[model samples]
Each structure stands twice: as C-alpha cells, then as structure tokens.
Target: MVERCKACGFCVEFCPTKVLALSSAFNSKGYHPPHVVNPEKCSGCDLCGMYCPDFAIYGYKLETGQAHVATAASAVHRAQRGPGNQSTGVEDEG
Candidate 1:
C-alpha cells in the first residue's frame, strides 16, 4: 500500500521483520521514504507506526482482496517480547 511517509526511516530501522528499506526516490519533503524491499518478508505488523514520529506509515494484512490494518495495542507488546509474530496476532486485543 502507498503511504504518506515522511522518510524518517524509523519504519525501516525499527522493523523487526526488516521488510522495509529506504527507496532511491525522494518524497516531496526531499527525504527518501522506506519501500518494500522484500514483500515476502513483510508481516504487516504495525510496529512501524509505533515509532513513526510523523504517523505517516502503517502496514496492513492483505486477505481476500481486502486489507486489514494490523492494529492491536498488544502488537507493540508482542514485538517487544520477540518474534513468531508473523501477523501481529490480529485477534489479540491487548
């Protein structure tokens, strides 16, 4: 999904899954936003949004031609705890 990222790189640097990377292209603000370097590596966890200062980016789980935002408060908790959080446990309501 396209995001209005500010190119802070927080999403890339803090992403546990490391699916994101700085794109060669620059944003309107002249900063290079992160891109999907490996779509296969993405887990659609909202950890990127947790640390984003601009609140410009977040990930969504694509299912049945629809996208659901991975937004459980526990998602941040699970991220801090460890891996195996491939989908942010979408049903975990914190």
Candidate 2:
C-alpha cells in the first residue's frame, strides 16, 4: 500500500509512540501532513492509525515479518505519559 496520508495531523497528535509528526511542508489539502520522524524506535505499535480522524495514518507489514511505517522516517519521538495525547506530541499545551 502507498500510505495515502491526508496530512491532517490528527494521527501525529494522538500517537502513543510519539513516532509521527506533521511535515513542515503542506499536503494537497494545504495541511501539514503527518510523517514518521523515526523508525528505529517506532515499535510498530500502530497507535497513529487507531486514533486518526481521517484514517490518514496506517501500519504496513513488511516482508521481513515486521510492520513498519510506509514512508521515510523524518521527528524526534518525545514519549510522555500524562492525562491526554499531549504525552505523544498531539497537544502543545495539554
């Protein structure tokens, strides 16, 4: 699959693994789309796709018997545990 992301940023904000982020550039919808900043530490938890409002994010199972982010890794995943998605960089001031 091509990982047809809409760049809505919903998944980036709700990721539990803090692996997703909004691209500095905009998508076709004029929105800064979400992309994986890191892969080595991704853990392939698929939390991004779970809470995505537009289903823009998803997990891809690679041939190596491992699931991986479909795109090139790009943001630093700042893992935090709090009352909300803020723990995952989804909220700036949560």
Error of 2 at 82 (Å): 31
What TM-scores do the predictions have? 0.58, 0.56
Off by over 4 Å in 1: 1-4, 63-94
lDDT of each: 0.53, 0.51
Q: Evaluated with TM-score, which candidate comes out highest?
A: 1
lDDT of 2 by residue, 4-87 (tens): 455656666776666666767654555666666654446556677676666555655445344455432233233323234233
RMSD of 2: 10.3
Cα-lDDT of candidate 1: 0.53
Best by lDDT: 1
Ten-residue segment with the worst summed lDDT in candidate 2?
A: 85-94
The parts of candidate 2 lying over 4 Å away from their true place are 1-8, 60-65, 71-94
